[model samples]
Target chain A: GIQVEQSPPDLILQEGANSTLRCNFSDSVNNLQWFHQNPWGQLINLFYIPSGTKQNGRLSATTVATERYSLLYISSSQTTDSGVYFCAVVNGNKLVFGAGTILRVKS
Target chain B: GEEVAQTPKHLVRGEGQKAKLYCAPIKGHSYVFWYQQVLKNEFKFLISFQNENVFDETGMPKERFSAKCLPNSPCSLEIQATKLEDSAVYFCASSPQTGGTGNTIYFGEGSWLTVV
Candidate 1:
């Protein structure tokens, strides 16, 4: 099984602040995705980046496959952004997830 | 449908009972995937289907877990003799799997199961 490690197990920030989350995998992957688990338990897809950089509004992500690492950046955070963020990689036939980074944004 | 749909958002069962969950993948999508979130932050892949056929099911517990994706119907995951640890949020995801975009997967709101 492929191993995934997320940094800064937990995070707290004020609304409108900025933060970055990281994910590192032990093996190269064919697909790498970032997700935000909402309060209601919906796993929202943030990014599906195997390599290179992508941005969607205030959220952005970059994957360095060669280094087996990825980074997610959230700018102008909102109270709605408080949730758990996960990075999962496709290991052969399945998607292996990291433990996740818990984020709390206070207004 | 634009997104995956799961039925019975929450379910409660007793130990050794049978529990089942259902998911309807997006229309026209050919790939369906199932995942289990035990704790708030941990997710485990359960199975994946390429259309109506099983693609990979390495994460399923052979003795207690079974899944099926029959044509013209929603996919199902069944756990017989459910244990306390079987309590978790089961999520269903799907992708169009067309062109170069098939690898991107989308998830549903999830079905929460609890064993008391």
Candidate 2:
């Protein structure tokens, strides 16, 4: 089993602001995914970076496997981005999730 | 285009009653996973199935939680004699057999279960 810890348990930002959320894992992982749980409880997959950098629209993520850390960056945040961001790592056969970083983007 | 379909967006059941939830993985996916999210906490993996066989079920409560994935049928998770703690959002996800960065896992909208 792998332990995942997400930093900045809570964050508040004004629209157009930028934020960076971090996830630290205890062991090496084969699968890593970033998910956004919207206000309505939909777990939207944001990125699936295991050990590289990837960008999708206003969101981007980088995972350094050797460092055992991952970072999620959101630029020009919008009200729709207000929600909980989760980092899940697959260790062995199951995926373990982090506590999540709650973001509040005020418009 | 790729989506995991879950049934019963919301469910309410009395204590000690049985609760069942169903999930249909994407057409080409071979792996299905079930997770439970309580409040705003991290999701807890309950079970995972590779095709029609159970791959892992380490997080399931041996006494009350059981799941099945039969060929040509939707996967199902059943909780018997549910308790108050059983109330949470159940999420179903799917990925390909050769999972990695290339094969990203997708999740369903989740089913909200309230046990009173």
Candidate 3:
């Protein structure tokens, strides 16, 4: 089993601000994904980056597999971005998840 | 359209009652996973299936929990004699196959279960 830790457990930001959330894993992973759980409790997949960098609109993520760390960046954030961001990794057969970073983007 | 579809967006059951949840993975997906999220905490893996075979179920509670995935039928997770602690959001996810590298798992909206 792999251990995952997320930094800055809580964050508050005004609209248009930028922030970076990080996830650190204890072991090598083959699958890495970033998810956003909305206020209504819907889990939406944001990124599935096991390595390299990827961007989708205002959200981007980079995973350094060798370093066993991943970073999620939100640019020009909107109020709709307020929610809990989760980082999940798969070491072997099971997917391990971090506690998540709660972000509040005030309009 | 959502890749994974879970039935009964919300469920309420009395303690000691049996609870059953269903999940239908995306077409062509071979792997299906079930996770439980309590409050705002991280997801707890329960079980997974690859096609019609059970792949991994180490996270399942041996006593009151069981799951099945039959061919041409939707996958199911059943909890017998449910307890108060069983109240949580049950999420169903699916992927093309298993392995760490490059596999992307998609999740359903989740079924909220309240045991009283």
The native-contact fractions of the candidates, in order shown, are 0.61, 0.61, 0.76
In model 3, the clashing pairs are: A30-B100, A30-B101, A31-B100
| Segments of candidate 2 deviating more than 4 angstroms | B99-102
Per-candidate chain B TM: 0.94, 0.94, 0.94
Per-model TM values vs. the true structure: 0.95, 0.97, 0.97
What shift in Å separates residue A57 of candidate 2 from its native position after superposition?
1.1
Across the candidates, what are chain A's individual TM-scores? Answer: 0.98, 0.99, 0.98
Best to worst by TM-score, what's the order? Answer: 3, 2, 1
Q: Any runs in candidate 1 off by more than 4 Å, and if so which? A: B98-102
Tens-digit lDDT track of model 3 for A51-95: 999999999999999999999999999999999999999988768
- Per-model i-RMS: 3.2, 2.2, 1.6
Q: B1-116, model 2: which lDDT tens digit per residue? A: 36899988999999999999999999988889999999968699998888988888888998999999898898999999999999999999989885333478889999999999
- Per-residue CA lDDT of model 3 for B1-116, tens digit only, reads 34799988999999999999999998888889999999967699999888988888889997999999899888999999999999999999888866334688989989999999
TM-score of chain B of 3: 0.94
Fnat of candidate 3 is 0.76
Candidate 2 matches the true fold with a TM-score of 0.97
Stretches > 4 Å off in candidate 3: none
Ranking 1 against 2 by DockQ, winner:
2
